[model samples]
Target: MGVDQNSIWNLHNKLPSFPTLNKNEQTEVLIVGGGITGLLTAYELINIGLKVMVIDASTLCSGTTGRTTAKISAQHGILYDSIIQSSGVEQARQYYTAAMDGKDRILNILEELKMDIDIEQKDSVIYTEYDENIQAIEDEFRAYDTLNIPGKYTETTELPVETKAAVTMFHQAQFDPLLYIKQIIDVSIKQGLEVYEHTQAIDIEHGNEIKVTTDKGHEIHCTYVVQATHFPFFDPLGMFTTRLIPERSFIYAGKNENPHLKGMHLSNDTPARSIRTAKINNEHAILIGGEGYVVGKNKSSADPYKQLKQTAYTLFPDHTFISQWSAQDYNTMDSIPYIGRLKNKYENIFVATGFKKWGMTTSATAAVLIKDLIQKRQNPNENLFSPSRFELTSSVPTFVKQNSHVATQLIKGKVSDEGKSIDELKANDATTLFKKGKKLGVYKDEQEVVHVVDTTCTHLGCEVEWNTYDLTWDCPCHGSRYTYTGKVIEGPAKKHLKKEEL
Candidate 1:
C-alpha cells in the first residue's frame, strides 16, 4: 500500500463543506480559523443566539487540528513542575482544572452525539528512557500530588523498552480526532454557524467596529473577532511572533499484532517519544510519534519520518509502516497557553493558541474561555491565560533565547555557503544559492523542471531553509512554512515567497 502523507484521522471521513466568502457580510462574531478551537467557540456563541461566522484559509480543521495524535488528556509531558515553580500553586491548579474541564467537555459532546469513533478510555503515562530525566518525572509527579491530580509515580511503564521511571495519569482518552471533528461540525451547523472555506482573513481593521479583510477582497464586519489560527496570523502588537515558538513532530502509524502502548505513552526524553493507537472502521493501527525539532533549527538531508519509522520497528519488532505524517505546534514562552483576548486595546478581538502540542484538551477550554469573554461573564482562569499578561521572569528568558536564536538565524542565513547552481542541482531536490548576492531557493522536479524563489522570509526578512522531511521551505526564525512553489503553507508570513528571476 502507498504510504499516506497525511494524519491517519483523514481516512474514511469527509467533513462538511462551505463556500468561500464572495461579498462583505456582517455578524456578531467573526472567527478567522475554522479549526477545532474556532468551531467550538463558534458553536458556543451561536448556541447562545449570537450570529457567528467562521472562515478558514483552506478546508476546515485542515491545519494542526487534523494532524494530531489525538490524545485527549490533561497530561502535557513533564510540564506542571516548571509551571508551579514559575507561577504559583494556585495558577498551576487553575491550569490543570482548565485542562480537565476541556477533556470533560469533549467527552460530554461525544455522549450527546452518541457517535462511535473508536473512543477508548486509557491511562496516560510519562516515562523516561534516560536516568537524567527521572528526576524531572519525580518532580512532575510531586507537582501533581500537590495539585490533587490523580496520578502515580512508578519505576517503569508498559512499553517494550528499558526505562528509568514513569508517571501515570488515570482515565484519559483517545479517539479518531477527525471523526469527532466531523460530529462537532454537524452539531455546530445545526446551531446556525456560517462557515467559509478557502477564505483567508488577511487584515483586521479595528475602529468603532472590527472589519476583517480576506484574500478575495471580501470583508467581514463584526462586533467581535477571534484569531484562532494556529499562530496568530494578524498580530497588531507584534507580540505573538516573539512570544511563541514553533516545533515540528513526526508520526508513523501501521498495524501490529500487539500495539506497544496499552495506554497513551510519552517518553520524557529529548526529541520525545509518543505512542498511541487508532482503531477506525474496524482497522487498527499503532501510531508512534516524536522525532521532533524546532522549526529550521536543524535543516539537513535526513528525514524525520524515516527515523520515526525505523525507531518504531526497532522497538515494536512487528511494526509495519502503513502511513506517515508530521504535525507543527507552538509553545508559549511560559508553559501555559495564551488564551483569552488578544490585547487590552483590541478588547473585541480574542485569540487562542500556543497549545504546546496538547490542543485536544486545551482547545476546548480555550473555546469556553473565549465564549465567557464575549458574553461579558467572568471566568476565573481568564487572567492566567491572557495573551497580554506577560510574566517577566517565566517568559523573559525564553524571549531572550528565542529572539537571540532568531538573530543568529537571520545573520547566519545571509553569510552561509551558496549551494550548487541551478545546472548542478539534483532532480527532485532543493537548495539555497546566492546569485548576485540575492539568496534564492531552487527546486528541481522529477521531470527536471527548475523552480526558484527568493529565500528571504516575508515575515521578518530572515532566511528560509529547505526542510527535506516536510518538503517545504521553513523559516528558521518564526516557523513560517512555504511550498517549493513558494505558496504560503503555515505562517506568521501571509504573503507567498516571491519567485526568483533565475
Candidate 2:
C-alpha cells in the first residue's frame, strides 16, 4: 500500500504567512528559529513586553516540528535510571522537575487561552514484553520511586499486547503540535512579535549588539540572539558540530474505530515501538512510531516503514493505515538539553536545543527558562540546563564515539561514489557520481529532467548521501539536508549546495 508523507495535523484555520527580511530590522531579542522552540520563546518574552523577532530558514513547522508524534510526556524511555547512573540522584530529580514544569507550562497556556488543541490527559508508560528486559523496567520504576516521582510498576496496562512489566507515569499528555504552535505564533503576534519565514540566518556578528546576517543580505540587530533552530546554523566557538549527534525516527498514524489504546506507550524492548491515540476528524486513531537510526545510516533501506506496518498489524489488528512522517532529533553529549546562554563570552546569545526527541515537553521548558535568564530572574533550574555545563564523566565517551562515527562517515562519503551512470538513473530519484575526482550529486525529476549539485555539505567538509524517500541529498555528518536540486532544507548548514552544470 502506498502511503503519503503527510503528518496527521489537521489544522482547521489558515495560518498567517510571514515575509522574508528584505531589509535590515532591529529588535530587542532576535530568535533564529520558527519551530515550536523559537515561537514559544517569542511568546514567553513578548508577553513580558520584550521586543522580539523570530526568523527561520524555511517556512514555519516545515521542519521536524511538523512531524512529531506529539507525546507531551517526560517519560523519556527508562531515563531516570540512566540519569541517576550518569549524573546523580539529585540531577535526575532536577531533570524530572524541569520536565514537569514544562508539561505544566503547556497546560497552563492551554487553560489561559482556553484553546482546545485536542489535548488529552493520558498515562505515559514504558513497558517490556521480553523477560530479559523486565529487570530494566523494574529498575526504572525504582528510580522513579527513589526520586519521589509518582509512578507505578504493573504487569497490566492499556496496551493491547502483553507486558511482562510496565512503568507508568499517570496523567502525562499528548496533543497536536501543529495546533498548539499556531496559537503560539498567533498570540505572540498580538503582542507585537515579528516573525520572518524563509529567511535563513547564515551568520551572526558579535559585539555590544548582535547583528544576524541573513541569506537575503539583510541584518537583524538585537541586544540578544537565541539559537532556537533545530541544529544551530551559526556556531563558531560552541563546538556544537562535534558534540551534537542526530538520529531519525519514523511515525505512522492510522484510522481506528474506538481505539483500544488509551495511554501513550513506549516499549522498553529492543528496537522500540511507541503507541498513542489521537483524534482524526473527531474519530479515534492510533499512531505507531519507532524504528530509529542514525541520520546517515539508512542511505538505502529495504523499507523500514513496511516493517513498522507489519509490527503494527501484528499488535493491533484493527488499524487501517493512513499517513506516515519522520522526525530528526539531536542528542547532547549528556542527556539534558542546552537551554541558557550560549557561552560565557556570548552571554547575550542564548540557545535552546538537544531535545532528544522529547521536544514536546522540553521546548516549553526551554522557553520559560530562557525568559527567566533574559529578565535576570532567579530560576531554580537555570544552572541545571546551562549550555556550558559539562559532565565530563558521561559526555566524554559519547562525544568521542559520536565524532568518530562522523569522521568515518566523512571518509566513507568522500570515497563511496559508486552510483549508476546517467543512463541507468530514473525519474524522481537521486545518486552521487564523480567526474575528475569532483563528487557530484545527480537527480532525475518526474518530468524527465536532470539536476546536479556538489555533493559536499556546506556545514562541514563531509560528503552527502541521497535519500530516495525524501528526494533529497542528506549529510551523514551533521544532519544537513538538501533538495536533490541543491536547495538547503535543513541545517547546521546555511548555504545551499553548489549547483552543478549538467
Candidate 3:
C-alpha cells in the first residue's frame, strides 16, 4: 500500500517551518508560493537588491517540489517534434535553449556554492515499445537535428523493458531537488529574503497597489506579485483556470543494488513509464513513475499505486517496493508553460504555471523569465511562453473542448446520487450520501468516528467525489481537492468545505 506520502525526497530532506503571517506587511516584490519557482525567483531578486518576500501555505519545499521525480534534463519526453509542428523551428530552438539554460543555471549555482547535493549528469531518453510510436521517435530526432540539439536515436537501451526505439539527449542530470532548493533558501535568507510559512494567501485585491490578503486577516502590499502555487490561487486574468488542465501522476521507489540504467528514461507509449535512479538508506534504488490521468477521471477512485506496483515488479523483479507517491501538475493548451505577465495590461502582476510534468527545468526557466520581466529587461522567450499568445485555430478548439468536458462533469455531478449510506459504511471507509436533499461526504476512521463535510467544491461549486485511496474529496470539473474533514488541500479551491456533524 505504498502511496503519495512515501516520496524518496521526503525521507531524506526536512525543511524548517516559518511563523505564519501575523501582521500587515509591505514589500517591493511578493512571491505567493515557496516552491522551486518562487524560491528561485526570490533568490534572483534578493541578489539584485530588491526587497522580496516569499510566503507558503505550508512549509518551504512541501508542495510539488518535494513530490517530483527530480529529473533535470532538457529532453522532455518526445516534445521537440510537437513544438516544431505547433510553433516553428525557431520557437522550438528557443524552447530547447530555455530548457538547457535552466539546467545550466542550476549546475552553475551548485558549483559556485559547492553544495554536495548528490548531483550527477546522465543522458535522458524517450523510448517506445510499440511499433506505432517509432515514427514519432524518428520525427523527434529530425526535430532535434533542425534545432541543432545534441541527441541521437537508438534501437537499444539499458532498460530491462524491451524498448524498440529511443531518442537520447546527452549531458542531462538528476539530483535531490529538496537538497538543491535548501541551498538557495539558505543563501536567500542571508541575503534578506523574508520567508513566511504556514501562511495561506487567500486572494488578491487589485487597486493602485496589489493587496494580497492572507487567511489570518493580514494584507501584504507589493508592487509586484508572482502566483507560483502550481495552480494560480487568484486569477484576475481568468486565463489560468480555463486553459490549465490538472493532472496527477504516480511515482514509486524500490531497493535495488544494481538497477537498470544510469540515466533518466521515459516510455513514449500508452501507460507511459519513467525510470531513474536514487539513493535510499545508503543503498541504490530505482524510481519508477508515470501513470498520469486528469484528476477525477477515475470512476472507481482507483489507486495508481496498484498499477505502479505491477510496473515496478515487472521491470525490476529483484527489487523490493519501498515507497509510492503522487504529484499534481497543470498542462496548458499548448505544451509550453506560462511564465510572464498575467495580462498584457498588468506589468506588475506575474504568474508561472502550467509546467505539465516536466517541471524540473521548466521551473528554473520560469524563474529566470519572470525575473527578467520584473527588472524591465526584454526576454526573447517571453512571446514563446506568453499567456495571451493564443492560436485561434489551434488553441481555441482545445479551449472549447476542455470547457465542454468540464460542463459535462458538472452536469454529471448534479445528477449522480450513488453512494452507500453513512450508517452502512465500515471503519476506514468513505462514501458520499444524498440524505434529506443534501450531498455529504462521510469517512469513518479506524476508531469508528465518522467525519462528514459538504461535497461541493468551493472553487467552482462542482460536486466533490470521495477519493478512497488518498482519503480526500476530488473535483471532476477543475481538479480542486480537499481533505476528508473539509480542509482545502489543493486549488483552484481557496476555501475549505462546509463541515457537518456525523
Best by lDDT: 1
Model 2, span 373-462: residue lDDT tens: 999998888888887887788889888888898999888988888558888987776777888888999888888799999998988889
Clashes of each: 0, 0, 2
Clashing pairs in 2: none
Quote the lDDT for 278 in model 1.
73
On a 0 to 100 scale, what is the lDDT of residue 157 in model 3? 90
Predicted candidate 3 versus true structure: per-residue lDDT over 1-502, tens digit per residue: 2123757888877776688889999999999999999998898888788999999997887778899998999998788988888778988899999999989988888987788767778999999999999999999999988888898889989877787899999899998888888889898898899999989899888889989999899999999999888888887768887898888888889898767476788999878898898765468888888778888776434467887788888878888877787778888887788888877557688888988888888888888888899888998889988887886645777789888888887778876865587778888788877767777888887788899888888898889987666777888778788877888777688889999865
* Clash tally for model 1: 0
lDDT agreement with native, every candidate: 0.85, 0.84, 0.84
For each candidate, what TM-score against the reference? Answer: 0.96, 0.95, 0.96
lDDT score at residue 93, model 2, on the 0-100 scale? 92
Better of 2 and 3 by TM-score: 3
Q: Where does the lowest 10-residue lDDT sum fall in candidate 1?
A: 1-10
Which regions of candidate 2 are displaced past 4 Å? Answer: 1-4, 10-13
**Which is the winner by lDDT between candidate 1 and candidate 2?**
1
Q: Which stretches in model 3 have alpha-carbon errors above 4 Å?
A: 1-4, 280-282, 299-303
